[model samples]
Target: MGAWSKVRRVFTRDANIVTAEDLLSLAREDRLGGRTVHVTNDSALRHSAVWAALRLRADLVSMMPIDVYRQVQGLQVEVPKPPVLISPGGSEVGIKEWMYSTQFDLDRAGNCFGIITERTGVIGPDGRGLPGRIDLVELGEVTVRAKGPQISKYKICGVDYDPWDVWHERQYTVAGFPLGLSPVAYAAWSIEESLNAQQFARDWFGAGIVPSGTLKNTSKTIDRKNAREAKESFRAAVSNGDVFVHGADWEYKPIQAVAQQAQFVEARQFGMGDIARFFGVPGDLIDAAVSGSSVTYANISQRNLQFLIMHLGPAVGRREDAFSRKLLSNPRYVKLNTDALLRMDPQTRAATIAAQINSRTLTPSEARALEDRPPFTEDQYAEFDRLFGSRSVPTPPPTAPTGATS
Candidate 1:
């Protein structure tokens, strides 16, 4: 017992070392009926629906730009992005890649962790230095221990890290729980069902347990040796892709496996919908069919808006809040521009922009910025005036007092 304790202490103290026992303890396995299905982070990704849902959310969030803003004079103004926001994982990993990695982990495991590798000289209000670079750690390697509503320790690859030294974000949280609830863990049953169906299909086809058809002698009874000889001859001919010559007494009928195949396919489709629900993704977004209901959108923008409001909005908001608290100081916050996801077709976007400009809700310059164009120069304005008249509204003739105005 003393020797085992010493061995355990040595493994825990060394960050670079690991044992087979530690890895086996961390691996997740689900036993359904008589079979065991390994449910690790990588194995969960084998399911197509899980892959599509995670990819959709991660790709969308990563492409959207993240900006920092400061509150000044009761209004928010955009500020220069810090180093962390620009290249969080270092020069090789841009903000997009970093965001994608973190969002993927958050969607799958309901939490993400990173090591704060670099810090700026500027200190936040909490007396802690601001992080300049954060390198994300794999979810499998991290083990978290927490007190009520607070994390007590983080173990990554057998080494302990202080909570302050680690960057952590969580979603799908419950009251009095320090760690978030994992979608993958909750949907393990559905995943196992799908995986089992897939394996059965593979085995059914690969092993050739079910023959295409059966042969029988109708004219007279055949001896066991003759029957075996006939079966072997027929199999050899079929395997060689040649026709077997036989007498009229023998009959062959082909069988179709359509019904059997369809059963497993339907099971897979149902599993797809269940997985989509677990990840807060729309079934149609991942091409999974939803039964008995058809929804149509006037435009893609409206569809995107619906998804944002109903599903993705709260998650995005939570992420922004996390970023603000961990990466910025007081009075400064972070925002992920969701306009990228709400982009419409050219015609609809043009009409929307024109309407906003006409209603004085959006300026022409601001509209141009949205389209990634610079404001018109003097020469360009002159050319526009030559083709079309000046855009400025005309002034009315001088009027008398309000009571006498005509």
Candidate 2:
């Protein structure tokens, strides 16, 4: 059995799983700037860096088109016009929106939920249901209702759905837990640290660029009413507008403190980097400072390749497997075409395509398709042959070195 299967079995059979009451308590513990870190999708996304990272990843995955293929005699054949492929939900938004929503939820909450509907009168001979329509459910609205280790049912949008009817995609989960652990929840301290820093900066500026200090009235016998008036006047003059002048020893001594003194900027940047790590996005990708690599990157395609392999590969693989298991049967698989992200400069791409065409790994028509161009017509083929025809030439034998052999 696979590792996931083992984990599932252990989780389903474990007796020490948290009860419904505990799960509710854990799930509900979220507040902004509170002692306990709240890591809900809405609250966590308030940070711009986190939102941007999630958006980038979701769009990157969802923008890719999904291809469905069937196995016939041990060969995979592309399935065109499959009901599930065309429209998974029988809605106007189609697959891209569905994928975007699902990926967003998966990235933010570490879980995604979908409802599956089988096609009517389209069942195959093997008694397997034909996939008809699938719909994505908001991750925030779904609640896991479990009895011991096993999940009893899923409550979504005030309706109860059987475990079989709901398709669940989850990320990291601890032992005996039916729900996946969100990155925000796991890294709440880091995210909250960032949020606190942001709030501090806002308050600092809101209090004006002037630091906190005492305002002394050197005038003899100042009344309480006069002191209050002077305080409000000073605040209005300093915070509301620009320059202000005070008469007679009524001076405002400002506290000398800077953000750099406390490394506030550095802390905020570090927090952003931490969030990026949780999302599997490179710090440099989201404009966060890349500490080690300060050199300029000349090869964008190479960087994109590394990102695809190192960062996005696992998430995309999980999505593919989920589609394969739930929407397709054995021997058939689903794939998200990532060639678009691998595109290079025109000249470089042309050279690469030429190499592939020469090696028979890609045809001219296929290369054209990659460029979103039409396939070659017979006339174009004739022209190509005329320009570059097959030919064989005889080579002269090597000559002896001049005046060498005696």
Candidate 3:
């Protein structure tokens, strides 16, 4: 017990390891009734100790610099006469900085000292043993005529409130962050955080349970390549389970793996759905299924329909400019074109798909090439005809224009 007490005393007595120091300024009122005052203080060394307080106010105090030892009337001025306020608020035409003021007064002859108090709180190993202390200091003041509040009120560059107001800014306390770091400048941050959060929930948590205010599931979320790959993996895993099991002698381990992978994929779907919804896209149309081709099919199907209705529908009908706006308003066209083009040339299809993502105009050849591909469905064509007014079927390649001047 005695040894422990000695160890504690050694740490406690180490003045260098723990000491308090703060700067303060004091200014005296004018003796002749119009001189400026400047104040300074040293936080640590006691009144009896040999040390002067540090001066905080700037050197170029006013428009011109005055030496502290200089005097205006020769009253044996220790501090300079006409002391310009280093603190910004004083008699300045314009002010933009936080200023601190200490209580001050001057006698018939201008003489001053700034009074200030401070507290120190530190914690470490001997936790409770370490205690905080309050310190008081008196600093010499300067005689000055200008008043900060009278000249300009307490003004600061960025902060508009009182310096003390900073204390009430909700803090985490543990992490020491303003709990509401949510600044007006970052208005879009909430949307982005919402976007990321919904995605994380979908990717990590299971599917079908999507976060609120996200894009709708009816829009595409999964990429063609990714959707294809995940679908293939899911299918293979499911097939492997079937092969591994014989009538009634089911191997539980592989079955569980298959089920787990499916669940994982489902979670990804939910995540995608969450993302889609956050962006104001429909979540229902995304192919969040286990079938390799079908997953691709679902994502593609939704995008394609949107594309057809948007860009292609307008572009084919001679609304090229509107077509772009339509596409921009809905990105589902990208994957939609990919799904449709897969039936033609996969390489060109990928290129065209990439083009759509960048919002670049498709070349004439690019657009016409898609026309050569067989229609996705006879029923789809009929539906299109019903909606867009059926056109007379075109004659074979060499047909002549009947109304042309031959």
Candidate 4:
């Protein structure tokens, strides 16, 4: 009992620590239409357009394989089986799944976290505890607590984790905020509006495809129950454009309403574009209307380049920086290989490779490798040297004037 008390005292007592407060309590909540917009992965995914945009972005980042390399002198070369590259979080799931899940959280909530598990004592000089498993923690379940001297601690899954034990990648933040603000949270109002529109559509369509109208029975008095019964009977019988025969006394009149009053189609289309804009995704990319035209891009390559530059570039950059800082030692870095994403027409690709080789930016062998061909053999290498080894550049023979050429 005495020894246990002594150990407890050692952990509890601190020289400068005085108070602690949870950051969530201090956070300024953002609300819309008298309701707080709670942006969780589930809630954000409710809107099909928003979900499509997020899925596109998440898959774009996660599908790109991560390559780790060591920089020696001026050249960087690939390294195999780096600690972080191995099964993330000590789980059987490979890095691909880990990255996909993390990116989904990051895109949905504007933040992602991983709890590092150090299994051994061979820590690095900077105290990056030996390459350990990284377990992903849901952003919704994490809370920040402030200690004195500007230090922050994390409460994850109802358990306290020292800040050092967790890696948090946040999208944005401001002064006086202990937690990083997520893009989804920032655009919560737009997402909620889009969700509401989708829900309205489903509910409206589920009841009946036709618009609401009034039914009349001139011959017999129609009671409330009878009216309801007649409406149900009419819906069940002729909902799908089936023919209906009624007595001369029965009359059906569709409500005369302009689309301006309903505005269902316009509202839905607008919501798709608004939500897509918030996510930095092209509306047309997610099957949304593009200027009332089906044409979104001239070709697939142009669309891909636009997506990479506008949407995926910043995302990829953020992950690269975070991984480099948290998972690698000095002179070692992580790279997301996006070569596969930059596809082009065969003629264009060949022309681009030729230009690179001619400019000396890329070697002939390297271009061949890009095309999935093996390196040059000894004989090929000798032939290449024999042709281009001299200082003089190769030139084509001059042609005579158009009509005189023979």
Candidate 5:
């Protein structure tokens, strides 16, 4: 087992890549009042000083040295900073009374890191695209890491979303396996949590808690029951768009693939069961058993995700996170000769699969659905119609009826 297999409960995976420039753009798109990192560094905004600032509260301001002030654009947007007071002598109300002194200076990235690192933190992918721990730099010499978060900052599929309030905001939505999971308790009451429990008993069916034959039969029985439960989950998430039903093709392929190979899901289940037992929280709500550093209350979360992936299938790219319009065309997963391999390698397979694809045909409805989406332009549409008649597949246009008619 890898470290991930040890506790097997908590972990982060990077699917979101927001660069410094990207952050600046996002800030601009929001029409921020702060123009530069410097002006934004005011104590009130806390951009230059705090360990973390919510997107709603903070704005990225670019900073300029006295010499480079002219080169920086967008100076008009800088928000006004609050006044900083001077604290001096024993006569001062307090020795370090000026809260401004503790805040950050936007001109200094080092100081900015110091403040944010001390507050909330950022996690991202290492060069390898795996989840690396979150850390902030201090004075360009020291490193400060996120102790633990008070929210859900991890990227899923490919989006970074922190949409909840209260439990997911102040502290990590699920944290401190030993601390009793600050707000993980609320998840226990969620519909998703109960589904995890149902899936759990099914995964354990063949563990041989009973006679061999009985265990096999019991496992099958459990699987059958779980299937209906799983479908209920699928329908709920789909209708709600938590998991989408892509037309008919790509929608549930990932889910089916995951179900077929839910071996990873099973091991993960046992891991969470152990964690729940350790913490005395309900197993359905908390899964603390991590392969290594994965412990905490994310266990149930992981299981719920497994169930989703088991039904929806994994995806790639930004919009890929939400079930796309692709799935409705091929709901089940299949290989090159089959169906439901998400986003086939358009480049490499274009030639080889062309022959295989051309051999098959589609019905009127299927053919129409295959039409390339518009803004393909009227000219492009006419060209295709001229060539392939009505089919979207790449076959040469039908030979116009000899010399018969116009």
Candidate 6:
């Protein structure tokens, strides 16, 4: 048997394989000084900022409707969606869920993988059959082996799969690298800092690492035993939420580290922006305050358009290319309709549509179709004519002036 086969056999037989926690523990021990909260795919998601960034991208991408099209005589025509696009992971998982899962993985890990559960008779240019059903697998469950700039093997859940049988999409790729670089890995330091701050705050409040107040007997000197007793008594009373009444000689001062607490809050805010940058999401989109920057949008549509063009557009295009190549035959391609992202408010939409119709760029029926309304019926046209006059009116020819006749 080959080396990988033997390793696979061993993994199959071994019930207690090395877990992520085990690796994390090892990593923690090897930290080269400073606060190193080793971040993995699972641990990264626990951070609220990371979760929000990933979710925002994944949710938006998944919710955008996907369509298939073909080039016909230099004009693009919409085609019936393939069964694979409708139900990528078979009937159990629809396109929305499949997209969300894959996009989430892609955002975090920079790669998403799936197994080709079924294929159609159509052969792609690569001579491989087009995938009909692709069941996504968790990033942690699959191991990829690469040779130079190309992936050589994929071992998923102790089973070996050929590269042709696997569906892999990648982003943030660099030259000479087979696998995509993970954002979670690159932003580990920032994620770790935020996680540590959270832990520190929890410990500060929950574990009582710092005393809330200091009690001093200003008028008298007390021995160690007396002082200890007094301290215990004060703590016991405070623990029960009772008032500790004492003479004027006993001074009580509350230690409220307002500045220190504010520092933690500031660090968390900065971390949120930093994480947002790593994931290509605008800070304001996820409610992260951007310091020293004032960006205003005329409308929400403009903001969404900026995001689509600057950050999410390339990724969406990459997905379209991948889908087109793997799921469709020659000359047929896939498109993720981004119009949903750039939807305008009612007033803006109406004005824009009116302008388009008046300019003859868009027909009234097409504008109505865009709003999910059917074309105007004969009765509706009659009602419009009754309300106004005939839409078409002829201009009378101008009469030449008698004195300035040509």
The full ranking of all candidates by TM-score, starting with the best, is: 6, 1, 2, 4, 5, 3
Please say which candidate is ahead in lDDT: 1 or 3: 1
**Clash statistics: count for each candidate:** 0, 2, 35, 1, 49, 0
Give Cα-based local distance difference scores for all models: 0.80, 0.71, 0.28, 0.68, 0.27, 0.80
Write one digit per residue (lDDT tens) for candidate 2, span 1-406.
Answer: 5434443454454443322223223433345563333455677787877898899999998888789888798887988646776667786658778788878877877788877665545443346576577778776577666765477787787787887777688765667666765776555677767776666576566755564677887766678998889878887887754677887868678875554535657777888888999888888888886567664556878888989999998888888887777666666789888886776888788889888877768777787898889986777767766877822112235888988875
RMSD each, Å = 8.0, 8.9, 34.7, 11.6, 28.5, 8.5
Q: Pick the TM-score winner.
A: 6
Candidate 5 lDDT tens digits, 8-33: 12222232222212211222212346
Give Cα distance to truth, residue 376, candidate 5, Å.
2.8
**Candidate 6 Cα deviation (angstroms), residue 367:** 1.4
lDDT of 4 by residue, 1-406 (tens): 3422332233244632212111221222435463233444567777788789888887877778788888778799888746567678666778878888888776665667878775445455458564467788766577665533243677787888887788777664455434444555445566666665555465456644455677899899999999899888888766665655788999988764436436756666787888788787888889886465665577678889988998888878878987787677766778898866778989888888888777768877688788889976877767777988943323345868878945
The parts of candidate 2 lying over 4 Å away from their true place are 1-39, 116-131, 207-211, 215-252, 256-262, 295-298, 372-406
**Would you give me the overall lDDT of model 2?**
0.71
RMSD of model 5 against the true structure = 28.5
Higher-lDDT candidate among 5 and 6? 6
128-205: candidate 6 lDDT, tens digit per residue = 778989999888787766545666678888898989999999888777655666787667778887887887687567
Q: For candidate 1, write residues 304-372 as lDDT tens digits.
A: 999999888899999999889889987889999999899999999999988887787888888889888
Residue 18's C-alpha lDDT in candidate 2?
Answer: 29
Reference-based lDDT, residue 178, model 6: 59
Off by over 4 Å in 5: 1-374, 391-406
- Which ten contiguous residues of candidate 1 have the minimum total lDDT? 18-27
TM-score of 2: 0.73
